[model samples]
Target: MYRSAIFLKISLFFILLILPGTVACYAQSYKIDSLSLLLKSHPKQDDKRAELLLLLATEGMKFDPKQGLPHADEVLSFQNAIKNKNYVASAHRTKAGIFLYLSRFPESLESYNRAITVDKILKNEVGIGAALGNIGIVYMTQGKFPEALKYFLQALKKQEELKNELYVGIMLTNAGIVYTEMGDYKEAMSHYQRALSVFKKYKHFVGQANTLGNIGIVHSKMNNLDEAIKYSKLAIQIGDSIGNTRISARENGNLSGYYSKQRQPDQALKYGSIAIQKNEKINNIKSLGFNYQNFSDAYYQKKNYALSKSYALNALKIGQEVNVTDLKRDASLGLSEVYTALNMPDSAFRYYKMYKEYGDSISNDQKKNEITRMGMQYEFDKTEAVYREKQILAEGQLKQQQLQLALNRAELQRGLQQTALQKALLENEKLVSEEKQKQLIISQNNEKLQSNKLNLLSQQQRFDQLEIRQLWLYGILAIVSLLTVLIYLLNLSRIRKLKFASTLQLREAEQNNLKLEHQYQLSESELRAIRSQMNPHFIFNVLNSIESYIMDNDKRTASRLVQKFASLSRLILENSIKSLIPADKEWKALRLYTELEAMRYNNSFTYSFEHAPEISLSTILLPPMLIQPLIENAILHGIIGQAITDAHISVTMVQSEQTLIIKVSDNGIGLNRTSNKTLVNVVKEKSIGLKSIRERIKLLNLQYPGSASFSVDEGPEQRGTIAVISLPVLGVGSGEI
Candidate 1:
């Protein structure tokens, strides 16, 4: 019977050991399944159902956060309806998972604290440990390695007591990732190796692949190119065999990065392309973004600027689509580098500034989360103390009743002390759990804050890119406009010069035509005046001769004189109408005039005509009837009335300097003082032909300006007049007749 009693005690001990675990497992399953069903239901009940939903929601969150969020909301609504602290805490925990997945890290952190509060109130050490582990993971994601490690270690102790190896391994792996990011490759490798061993012992292929890929990434950061490539390739192969394309893509991208760092552009490009293809096939937008970024780097290394820019832009697009803040930040950096290489310093600087701002924002967010987490831990500890006190009071009441009936009070008392110690230990563990949960919450919040900062940076980069494009467009337009204006101005200047040249030519031609017309008019007027003067003189002389013949009654002499006068008159009239007459013709006219004068004087005067040897009579030309009047003046005025010893008048012509020099001189009683007046009057009244010659000279001077000159002067060595004339030396046979 004593053996049976001992067996019963052993059975009770075994039962107690298995009971908590089984109860915890059953409760967790019930909660998860109930939450899933409640979420699946089209409609929910009221506040009481909401409390049940909160319990289920927290349990469901471990496996399926997407399914847990609505239940969490229901629980929150129930807490609002009933003001239940426990329900509020459960809702907060469930919501934390949802928010964490949504990247709402600040809200998730707050929710995690609320959950920790509920766990403290219930004095649930395991729950607090689990929550702390999750918080540690969040911190790891945020790169808060120190804070995350502290919580993780605490969680590790709780998980060891619970013998939860899988969760412990996951936490270990996360710790490794944080260390790797911190550049503590050795410590990171150790953590990863420990996690890898645990995963392998459990036959967790996915976990193993993840750990291996992370190890490769750490090696890559350390610049162990060969080891990085080897491990990455192995991870990719394992992931591929297991149909885990997400892991495969990640590993491929890492390998590509390794190749890129080694400056093997071809190999980098090959792996990067494969990674992109796999990511695309799997519809993994986040992985695709990373792969595109890697490809951009590879192409950039090859100096393919256009392709590099395109891929970088594409990576940015995918990162935005996936809402992957880290990817977006990376893509923006790549794009900035591309622009910098392309000589777009402004764009590069803008993106770099955006990167810095986002980084600062991330740091600020981490600080806020850390503060909140510490505050929540403080609150959880207070609540846990209250729960511990309540448990002690209940144990004390049970012990008092048992003490009254005990035969072995000492043993009973020892057992009571042991139980009290155990209770005290549980309380200590609870405090540790609360501390760990706070640390994890802080870490998770920091991670979310970092993600938000990265997103802001990406948005700023996009804006900068748009601004850059606008600047380029404006610059191009301005340059084109400036060039166009320059061309127009040049064309306008050329046109103005051309017009000015045309106007100058026209003016020159018009001036020449005006000069020619004036010369021709003057020549015609001279000819008319000469004809008018000579016609009247010839008529009066003929009439005078006829009358003298009648008075003398010598009919035959009168008749001969009249006929000669008529013939001379006809010759003079005909020659006056001609434009030019030969020099010989002008001499003949002078001889005729002398003959007529001799007839008038009746042999009182004689005349001689002389020509210089240099004068070519055949080629020479003179104005018509110009010499006749000059001879008439000498004969009529000088020789007619004077008693001259030699009544002879000589006409001589010579050529000098393209001019005609003619002298008609007579030796008679030289002009008396009263006779000079009479000679001047006669020149004015009867020397119309001389006046015509003067007008012709004026016309010639106007026509050929400085080219011709005519003047009359007193004879140098004779009592006669000399006429000097200059004309352009026209070639032989070129003179007008």
Candidate 2:
């Protein structure tokens, strides 16, 4: 009865002291409801909406912690949708608080870290400091004192840079709490004293109260009972003055522990019950469980075993609900002590065994956390190394690109110089052609003059003959007349013979000049044909195929194709200037060309090369780039054009005594089956390569009768085309064949 009276007096005193703060809390609740209504009415997405959401989250946390989570999530969603990073950081920080309240430490840390990252991007120092402090709190909850201390000090430094006394005080108190938990009372007291000074300087009552409560915990740990009591009472008075149940609950719990150690059971019970009520009202399950265990100990000290057992059970239930290992450990110890006091050995033993089991579990969990931390550190180092390597590679690539650009500029300049040189050559050729035309006109004029002179001579000869005839008749001498007639006839016959020989010589010279002009045109056409073999479009397509192979990681195939391309290029460059090349050399170049084409088309067709065994390749002579163009036409116009899936080409050489028959056949669409008239016309008209070869054959035939002839027709199956060329066996000029 005396204990009940004392508890009643203490409860009444606390109620009176907290009455004003309670009314203020009621007004705050009204503001929260008004904000909720305002948020619902506002349809516009703006900063106003973000502000209202934040307010709702902060106010909702006072009564229903879980209620704040949705509001915080909405804030994050709204900020993210608007692409406002600064506000997003705020929203994340809010969510971290809600997660922490829900006892989700990992989620809390994740959210706080995300907020810090955003703030860093924005260069918002204040936001970063706050997030760091919150992260420290999460680490502290997980019993990572060193990590918690590190972050708290970092946040304090940032706060100091900003000269934000409130946050500085709050972070210092947080750090002090971590030190106290680690049992370093001296270091903890030093931080608390510095924080107390900062809070006092700023006149921030909440920061002051929080720091005071932390200081009390440190004092209690050091067994300084008087100083601990003084700090605890001062913190509780500050909390009651502000109507903050969270602070009051935390301070009162501290006071209850102080009183329990002083062996004042009634006073400890009084304060512990009040703390439990406040924590329960605010949904602070963690603090409520601790207060309950403290109440159980008070009851045990007072020899009230039944009540102690009851309170211990209550504490155990709350610890289980919250899943706080520290709460569970404390509850188990209290229950064991209570059961022992009640003389229930079995029950005591059971709880003592549970306490040891929880202790071991906590130790294992700490070890696992240590390993996880180490792994995270290693991964962070690895990621940093990779980032540095990528950065260096990017810089090197930039330098290489610059060098390539310079080279390209130099190449472009040289090409311009070459174009200028070509222009100059064209001008010189124009001058030469004009001079030749003038010379031709002069030669024609001279021939006209000579014809006129010849006409005059003939007229004179006619007159002289008439004169001689008259003289012979008048002088009466038959012999003289006959002799004169004979001489006239002889002179006339000699003149006619001389004119015939001169005309024959002039005709031969004109024929020789025409032949020379035709030969020059043929040489120019052959150069064009060799260039056309590696046309821009075909080269581009091949390059694209090489790129695809490289991107596909088929480097072996790409390398082989590149080498073949180089070989083909070398052959074209070397043979383009020559009129004729050995049959074997030409065949090798053809093979390389075909192989590259096949690889470009992903091996779409197969080809074979065969020759008569009786013929010697090295001893045979053929026009350079003669057969390749025919094979290309068969592939591009026949197989590729018709999209033949099972296409084949065969090149065969047959020796027939004096003529070498070279045949190229493909199992592709025949001439009659070709549907694109335009393409067919293009193939025929633009086949300068084939035309050039035909001209060369004509020239060869002129030199060596029946040297070359070509024809094309449908293949044996009527499903493909074949090109046949017959060239005389003019063996390598040595008659080796």
Candidate 3:
């Protein structure tokens, strides 16, 4: 039990260590050398020097973390020279990681705490969450399960607050590891299941591999051998696929143990041998010891006393050297069993006594009690979190309802005011009409009185009365026109106000929609980046090919292939991480990819790319890898399997009005075969390229609606698949600055 416990503890510690980590990924040799050269050359210890020192500490640390210590110390030594608080945090984190790798727990914790303090002062919530998680890892390695779980949950809270699903998944996985150590299988499974969903959604390979491996562990602990083997195989599969030797090695070892428990010596020995090889690569001492023990169990089960005794002795020797009590106890007990089988009474008794002595210090019952208590605590914490989330959701809904009610009331009030103003205008028109009629009657009465006067005076009176009547009629007309104009103006203003309000609401809605679309685009862009990356399978195969060539002493071909693979990989990675790259860069990358495929397949086919003379590739910006999948489909599906001599793929890009029309045509077996499947289905089921391209095109069309399209059909003369992509070209600023 002690041996198994130690294996689980140490294995989980290493699992958590595989992360982007405190500073960043370790640096390449050229980058580290350049930074070191700059540091040596630069006289002033200013911002540049601070940056160089930190880079050297972080990037160079992977090569020799101990050697990187002075660089980290120098960065932290003089804050006056390096005013950047970020440098202070980075330096601390680098120092902490280096110490952690070296198993210096106390110094690692101190450095991590310093980083957390700086992050707190800076109010950097993301940094704080990351540091807390790293600290939890350090604690876990120290065998402090309770404290590790506490810190893991704390970091989970912060990551949840930030809505960073990737880190959230990492924290959940760490918590699961703690729960597993606490002997709470139920809680461990719960956390692991949650983390698995997060990792799958984000396509985080490392998280997925770690979670799968740990879940397999939980099953193994529960005595579910079949499930344990199942998940362990899965973890190994993914880990091997991704070239992650650390977790894969452990899974292989675990699988060996499972087979040993099942009494399948052959299966057990197979996995045990594999585990030994992998563990030796990384010099994983604890795993190696356990693997040796498991290997011995296999041979013991087979009744091969000589080999069994030899392996058991090896395990005992390693256990003694490492001073692992549980491993020693298990190895000694196995030796006792083996000796008893061989009729060696004295040796068996001696080993049995040793095992008893080694077992004296561990208390299983107390650990079980602690596990029960922590499981209850974990459940309570989860319930409380759900309650808080529901409460916050309710509050947000209440606020939204209040806002909507306010808007409705304002709209109703405006409607009523407009109705009242309309009524008032109508009443003013009626009053003016009545006043004009009364004035007309009064003017007629005055005209009759002037008829009784003399001829000359009547003539003068007639002239004056006619002029007064004309002026009176003109005044009445003017007043009527003014009233009409005022009513019209008021009505127009009311309409404008309504229109303005409606337009404002519509604009707000559109902006919100655009905001949501932008977020979606960003997420899709990242997914596309991941999808567009060179396949791990392709990379591994090419490397294998290169290795084969080197083994055969074909150095020139091997070198060329190596260069092509590297260049193609760099270009694809550069293009994938961005929404748009230079058209020519993408074209060249695709060409390189085609060449690598050809070289890998023993020059099975050739390819060419051409752009119109009218197009300036440097100025034209287009999304990366639009035509990549098509080319891949053509090469892999259309040509590679077929017996077609002089096989060639031609790609052409020409400016057609606003569109940059590109075509990829390959000469091989035609796409329309007897399968009765559409080209899309062939692409979707056979590979990820076409589906990813479709999604990418859809996302692009959202930003520039209907400007991007992709299609696959037979080429001219119906020879093979002809894939076409239509992209709306733009100026240079369309890509990342």
Whose lDDT is greatest here? 3
Better of 1 and 3 by TM-score: 3
Give the Cα lDDT of each candidate.
0.67, 0.76, 0.77
Compare the candidates by TM-score and give the number of the best one. Answer: 3
Better lDDT candidate (2, 3): 3
Provide TM-scores for the models.
0.38, 0.45, 0.45
Q: Count the backbone clashes (under 3 Å) in each candidate.
A: 1, 0, 0
Candidate 2 yields a Cα-based lDDT of 0.76
> Which residue pairs show collisions in model 2?
none
* 66-104 per-residue lDDT for model 1 (tens digits): 656786686666464644355565566667766665445
The ten-residue window of minimal lDDT in model 3 covers: 10-19
**For candidate 2, what is the TM-score?**
0.45
Model 3: runs farther than 4 Å from truth?
1-80, 98-107, 302-328, 339-354, 357-360, 364-737
